[model samples]
Target: MAGYEYVSPEQLAGFDKYKYSAVDTNPLSLYIMHPFWNTIVKVFPTWLAPNLITFSGFLLVVFNFLLMAYFDPDFYASAPGHKHVPDWVWIVVGILNFIAYTLDGVDGKQARRTNSSTPLGELFDHGLDSWSCVYFVVTVYSIFGRGSTGVSVFVLYLLLWVVLFSFILSHWEKYNTGILFLPWGYDISQVTISFVYIVTAVVGVEAWYEPFLFNFLYRDLFTTMIIAWILWSPSDILEIHPRVFYFMVGTAFANITCQLIVCQMSSTRCPTLNWLLVPLFLVVLAVNSGIASSIENGLLYTLAAAFTVAHVHYGVRVVKQLSNHFQIYPFSLKKPNSD
Candidate 1:
């Protein structure tokens, strides 16, 4: 469908009636982070696009991922015979992460400060966040390393899904309630991750390899904290390659989250289960139920490609619609001409 429109005429009309409603009950957000963001946002010139700030922050996190991949491709940095990541890398990552977190907090405020707030800005911000969930978690996993020296990749995969789901659920909540109740876990996770990065810089990754108590290493504590807060299956359904499996899960989650954002922004009713999930669910059932064991991996890879293309296309269309409806450039601060 060359002319597929992700947002309908009704939804486009609803966008005109869209109102941004959100509640931040976390004292950390309200009392601390919000106040700090207010002060920091003043430093940004009004000419800067909030979307620019959002995109820059996202790039920094991606850069961190690249750095980790270069140093610890297998997540075995601390294991014997593996090259250890430098102390400076952790320090650099820590500093960059804090800055990204700050920019994220300040972007919306910057939009409000400059009187350039638009539904598109919120969409842009949250949409990027849906992907950032993967980057930040994967980079953090590099710190602890994978395998016997740290958490397993399979466990990390599961943790990453927990995070992605939490993110999707938050937006889903907004879809139903018409109010985004900002989850308390977000601030806590960001702060803790930043702190861990800095700590690793100071004490070195070796420190984490040691046990905190009762033969339980710091990795155990780290994993426990995440479980208190929020993998991969060997089942026939999960017969696909690990990397392909990760992409499939991540893409599916991103698609669902972006769709929910569309619903929230347009003030429309979100489907209880997005139509995209139907194939994903069926793949799971067919493989595990022994109906498609022989071609399970092929099905997974196909699903991965489909989900990724569908999500990217949906995002582009929705952005195009919103930009046209509002008469604003997606990433530019320039005023639209009346001509």
Candidate 2:
């Protein structure tokens, strides 16, 4: 009686959703705490299929771990507003994304291998993935960089457009549409998250190597990610907006190709380790600065730009490929189905 606040019957009905705070969750070891990870896991019976919930919870754990690791340094403005998602929340989210996607395997294999796949289950799984991807993306902006406002103003548009457009055009060919439905759309979402992890790691390194390198790198690399999404829009919209779709795709692709080339070339040079070049770059920047001629004398702007570009681009491709290979979903709610 010392402190009970009245909760209306309506509020009480929804308590299950918030009852998730009952358990203490760990960043690294989530599988051990099955119920802890799966907010709704408590409801499922031992006999009933628990693969989906288990996987989904694991996905959140993955994201949570990553975000905690990466975004903790900056203490961005967005962390406080996400309710339970604090600054360390990014890592939790990363792990969460990771787990949910990994479970995609159990969901499918159990169905195909165990002969348990159902249309309703498939639909629910996919729907979960789509929503999860959106959640993680939004969380990325919320925890770091400029957080929510920046996402609202810029990030969301590109993400939503690509996703929605893809959803639309995927139906043009039923077979192709089926492909788009991979783990219920988590395929693309996972790809995006993997890319972000790679890029962010590079950015972190840049911040350590030289403060402003990330700022420059962010400009170019961020453009690549956003452009890729925008360019993909045309492919998604061909059915609903054919002519316009082609125009958008054609134009965006050209720009995107240019970007990819520039980025890829720089990326190629990033890890090559040119110790001799560092001093040479510095001399050039020193000579070039003050006057236009002093460009590369002190290894100033040009060298910095070169370093940043390499880190960003290589990360974009290599990490993305690796994620795909491993089936780690960064952007989508899709879980792993391997093994």
User: What is the per-residue lDDT of model 2 for residues 115-215, given as tens digits with 9 covering 90 to 100?
Assistant: 33333343334334433433344444333333333222233334434553343333222222223322235454554564454444434322212111111
List model 1 lDDT by residue over 70-184, tens digit each. 7876678866677788888988898899899999999999888888899889998999889788778878876776545676555666777678767977888888888898999
Model number with the top TM-score: 1
RMSD of each predicted structure:
6.1, 22.2
Best by lDDT: 1
Mark the regions of model 1 whose C-alpha exceeds 4 Å error after superposition: 1-3, 209-244, 272-306
The CA lDDT at 309 in model 2 is: 48
Candidate 1's TM-score reads: 0.81
